[model samples]
Target chain A: MIRLLEHEGKALLGRRGFAIPEGALFPGLPPTGPWVVKAQVPVGGRGKAGGIRFAATTDEVRAAADAVARLVIGGHDVRAVYVERRVPPGREVYLAAHVDRDLGCPVMLACPAGGVDIEAVPHERIARVAVDPLAGLGDEDAAMLARALSPDGPPPPALRRAVADLYRTLVEEDAELVEINPLIVGADGTVTAADARLILDEDAAFRHPGRRAIPEGTAFEEEARRRGVIGIELDGDIAAMMNGAGMTMATLDQLVAMGGSVRGLVELHGAMARGPDHLAGVVALMASLRPRVLLFNIYFQFRNLDTVAEGIARAIHAAGPGGLPPVVVRIRGVREAEARRILEPLDCWVTDDFARACARAIELSGRPVLRR
Target chain B: MAILVDARSRILIQGITGETGRAYAARMVAAGTPLVGGTSPGKAGQAVEGVPVFATIAEAVAATGADCVLSSVRPAAALAAMTEVFEAGIRVAVLYTENVPVHDAMRMRALARARGACLLGPNSAGVISPGRANLADLNDARVRAGRIGVVSKSGTLTYEVIDGLHAEGLGESTVVCLGGDPVVGTGFAEILRLFEADPGTDAVVLVGEPGGAMEHEAAAVVRTMRKPVVAYVTGQRAPPAKRMGHAGAVSGAGAEATTAAAKLAALRSAGCTGVDIVTDVGAAMVAALAARRGAHAS
Candidate 1:
């Protein structure tokens, strides 16, 4: 999911025929008296994190923006802030169009209780209508959602159109989720989206054409993406690399079960096809973590294991003798004899047994690092 | 006698002219698993490893009477390829392509269900009824046809399960990969139902991972099944909100059932012989099968 910042989500909503509070990314003020200054972070609970501030004057806007910029909420740095024209105090509502995986359909969710986390709201309070993708949103769907917003009488005109438009945006924009929290129904009866959260579908990039994912995850993960492999950096001491995602998780589970902590994890996504040099690069990336021990648990069927063996051998040789941490490998599958022969001369502990190799890596990690 | 596919099913490659398609074609021919025909849009009337290639799935199905197809198209062509496969009235279509858009998957899944056909995956490793029909990523030479049916999300984990089963002198009656996507065509419940009814399958081995309510849903079906299920859900120690390689493997906020511990516990409560570690899967299956036999004897 490509999580859009508050401003970005609003930009998408605004362009797609929704009335959004006039806003600009911080440092530039929107033409208005009182403004709601919000920290542009991907995480939720920014309001409670002291990431939100309201300012009535231009000078106050700048001050609030500066303060929010220095704040980090949910371990994410507030790289920017969004300032928008504040809507007058009015009725708060929670509205969202999301893909309901359990139902295998798109659903428009409307709740009268807004401003707070929608999950906390009782199930009976929310109105959820599943929309047919092929047929698109219809009048009956809009009417049902509208009734949720205005139980006593006719819904505000802004809402009657918003439900259908919201569902349309989800389908056309290829978004997994489009949410407007505290969709304010002002005293003047105008509907305003004060806050928005849009999660674009990453796989829909083919249709979207230039929608780049805001680079997420740690530097190791980013590097892994660049290298065409998958890497996740965690807070641990043992660094493990595996041939497949399932193996990666199973390896992580095994290590943790044995009381071993993993600082780095790498999955050789297409490394086998890319050959030894690419795998060596991934190994080098793992080695940079300065882990206590490096563990490679790789299993193959049709693909030869020698390619990975050579890659490890290359990474070890490239690191030069005594230049890297302790290494343990558990590799077997097709061409096991050839794979073992390739890694025979390396100083690393090589075995075909998964448990023994994991145990060895854990034991070595307990020892103080000799090289790093 | 296999659940999804067998020696009788005529399997074709949707993008047979391409590199991956050609490789699958060659492997299918080598395995002697009903190598029928394929489609390449422009490369009609060609042959890859003795399998005939056509202009489209419709033409391939008409010419060779193919009821099943293994698609190996690029990501951009993944959706269109499945659309053609489904439109041609293919009974079973295995979308071997990965990175397909979620919307496309939803559409194809809906279409498959509407047509009452089975769609394996958008990121699927494919399926194989060992020694009968080999459509999966697993080496055909390595696996043998047996009574235990295997179903999993990850192909690599399936590899481990297959090896464990082999170590225990067990072999699969059929292996179905539900793909590693957040939303795949088939789920654990569907496959478990098939295994329960399959005469070839005496017991089932369900390999699950953290992320998605599919495991819990499968647990619902396991409660009614007479066949014993040995379940293993990985990623118990996976960090929060982290996708452990697969697009779908994550225990995010509010997704309580997607966590490994929760899924495993759910399946165990459904009477599955739970395996804590993946390596213990084969032994757990042995115990579960024995328990079933002991019950039968009583």
Candidate 2:
């Protein structure tokens, strides 16, 4: 699921008739008296990264926006700056609605302390209430949760009912996360969802039309996704490919365990339907990652390895002279020898030991391979 | 003895006129799995693989005495399809459709439970009693009928595990794919209970990915089972927080939703015989079976 930035999240809240601070994303901060220039990013801990800054003057707002927008968090480029009207300090109240998972239903969680990280909140203070998908949130429970958040005024009865309805909004829409941090209760008894954060589960996207666009992928991730494979860019120097999500992760862990850096990861999914051409695409993609070594730890049951091997051979030939990553393949099940026959001709090292393949990957990376 | 299905089981194919339905129907009939007939809304009097087709499941069951059904309808129509099968009084059913709404799954699950009918998957690959019944996505040529019982959420991984077992001279009595979706109609624990009671099932090999408490819950059942269980949890080395594939694989922090290590550890603590990789599944199965035998001798 792609995380919606705070600005977009707050706008969604606004559409749902919730109170939120006026926000705008701007290429440059306009000449304004005061504004909060926050970096629009998907990663957490942005406040600690100095991505969130309060600007007292137009020049400061412009400077902060320009500076923070250039910063990268979790490898994602911060393209635009989220500028908003800063709210006055008040008591922090936290509220979130998410699927409890274990209960197999949506749950609403609320606590009086909100501005700080929810994880850091004391367990006893956090109150959880399961919302029935069919019956929805009852009025009494909503009031209790809202009262638990603010004992003094305890959110007006109507507001508590609204909060309950918001939970319904999250569940029926298949939202993975709906968080309101520091639900500001002004001295006038006005309740506002001050900080909004929502993450909609992508698997349930068919239910919410036009909620998301077909996401753009990085050069590596795009190639892999197109082949119905999972791909991720990493900092390591070894480019690794494997069959199945489970094996891809194991290979990555093994590489990290062996003191090797993984540059990229490609997982071949539904490999039987995917012919040798998909394998060829994988080889070319790994070559583009420009790793010192390419590792394939494929374990197949019904799928044939001959097609995969043939694809790699074609990719190697297509790579031109010295165009391939020094390969280390560990293939098992369904035509092992035929796969080996295809790869052995390319001069790629072939083995079945996961650790050995990793060690070879490190060695070929021209780095001192550290023993696990 | 095997679990859920065997050679004697009579099966019916719902939506047999559809491409996937027709394909599996032909394979099942060809493999000689007592596929009596098929049901399509408007395809009555037609034939799929020379098996008579009826417009409704009741008519098909009345004519052929079919006990099992493989539902291959689309996601939007899966619940209705299963409901129709249940109404027809089918004892067991397998739903091969994915993307079923959560509410639909809940209704189907509740209806199946109330009716004393066993539902395999909303997104499941139909169960196979190799050499006897071929009602699944797995190719019969790749499998052998034997004493092992295999249950998994992944179709390809199930094929991999069964292939490994076959390589070790073991054959499965029934291989059930519980489905890879988060809110599938049935779960690992429920299937384990059925396997435990099945006379044909000598042992069970459970293939699980990191997600849900299904494996952990199943582990609790395995702790008390007389039959040996070898549990394999995939995604042990999954990228810490990045969801790879499968909706069920997503997890929350410190919550054991979908961490392979956490799942494996939980399974072990609950007295399950655990293996980390597919390659080691056969060896683990052997080890578990040996322990069971030793316990019996003692």
Candidate 3:
């Protein structure tokens, strides 16, 4: 999942027929004055972090943008600022639509008290309804959420329409979540989205042709993600790879338990679909970490293990004269005999035992120098 | 006698003509899974591993009386493929495609609920009742039929538990993969209830990880279950907010409830043995079952 920056999210909301404050990215201010200069970063709590600054007039907007640009919220450097015409604060209400992972269904949520942290909002204060995956968030349901948030009597038609629009954006854009925090309800009963937080499902990248998602993680992790593999960088001496996410975590747990320091970890997702050469590239990426020991813990059920072994063998050969870090491999499961044969001639320590292999990885991490 | 799939299930593959589908079809047939027919759009009347392929799920169901389906289509086709299976009246459906969009999964889950059909993962490893049914992605040779029912979100994690179980000379009665996605079709609570009712399952191993309240949901079920449960959550050393391969495996940065440690503690407090280490689960399971048997004897 990739969380879109506020400007990007607003652009999407504006396109999807939702009322968003007119905003422009850095260098180009929106056509109106009395704006809020907000730093564009994926992380939340930007307001508390001083990433948002209020401004009036073109001069004030420029000054606010400069100040906001200097601020870093949650370790993300403010590379750009979103300048949007400020919607006059009447009542800050919150609205959102997302799949409730716990409830196992799509849901629409709203609260009268919004601008603050929603998590802090009492459960009873917030109004939520499970969106019938079949019927979707209908007109009645939207009115229900609006009425619940209002609580006095009835809500404005625009508020009800906004509630429905939020759910529509969530489904139509293939977004995991579409949240409007501080959905300002004006005195005239107009609903304006003060901020938009959208997380697009990366798997639906195929359907969205031109939409660009912000890249995450370190340089190595970004490279790994580009190759359709999950890689994480740590501060240690061993770089390990595994076939599945669970196995990867379990291997990390075991290695850490045995006093092995991990420098990086990679889950060789779709190893079979991505052939040996592609796997070799991932191996090379792991080797570039220059860890003391390189580890691979692979277990396959229907997948061929030899494909992984072949990938390792190819990486060993492709590393050329410098070779690779001291390789420790724990490979098992389907096509084991063939997989072992492929790894036999390589300069690596191969084992079928998980504990023994992790132990060996730590032991090798303690070694002084690599002979290769 | 297993909870979900068994010897009597007439299973079908949604994308049986594709490479992955064809491969699983062959493996299913070789392992003696009751694979009746499959759906491959234009490949109707054709065969993969001697099982007939239909143009659509309705045709396959009508012709073969298939009630279970294993869908091996692409992520883009995940929603449509699942809709076909659920609409065809398949009681059990496993969406094997990985990287399926969450909205698509939600729609699929809703369809499953509306139809009263059991829907497994869009990225699930599938289910297996050992020698009885081979709906799971595992090789039948690796797992032996036994009295312990194993339900996990990860097929790979299940392997570690199975290996640990082997160390204690224990095998599984039924192995169910709930899928690795954050929004999956089923959860631990529902599966635990099924295992609780199964006559063959004496104990159950609930394998979970960080993130989501699914484990907490299961903790509620564990308190009332007659059978013993052993909970092992991975990512003990996982950095918070880091997506640990499985999209659902991330530990919420500040929220204590979604972390692996907190989840394990919740399950343990509910009166089940919770182990931090993966390899220790089997030994814990053995001890739990023993204690239960001792109580029964008394």
Alpha-carbon deviation at A172 in model 2, angstroms: 4.1
User: Residue-wise lDDT of candidate 3 within A153-230, one digit each (tens)?
Assistant: 578888888888888888888888899998988888888889999999888889899766678789999999888898
* Residue A314 lDDT in candidate 2: 82
Give the Cα error of residue B9 in candidate 1, in Å: 0.6
> What TM-score would candidate 2 get against the native?
0.84
Off by more than 4 A, model 3: A151-153, A320-323, A367-372
Count of backbone clashes, every candidate in sequence: 0, 6, 0
Q: Local error of candidate 2 at A112, Å?
A: 3.2
Q: Which candidate number maximizes TM-score?
A: 1
Q: What DockQ would you assign to candidate 2?
A: 0.25
Runs off by more than 4 Å, candidate 2: A27-34, A88-91, A132-144, A150-155, A213-218, A234-264, A270-279, A291-310, A326-372, B8-10, B39-42, B54-67, B75-93, B98-123, B250-258
In the predicted model 3, the residue pairs found to clash are none
- TM per prediction: 0.97, 0.84, 0.95
Question: How does model 1 score on DockQ?
Answer: 0.70
Which regions of candidate 1 fall more than 4 Å away from where they truly are? A367-372
Model 2 clash pairs are A236-A261, A236-A262, A236-A263, B1-B200, B1-B201, B2-B200
True contacts kept of each: 0.64, 0.15, 0.80
Question: For candidate 2, lDDT tens digit of each residue in A134-177?
Answer: 45678878888988887776477545855776786686666767
Model 3 whole-model lDDT (C-alpha atoms): 0.88
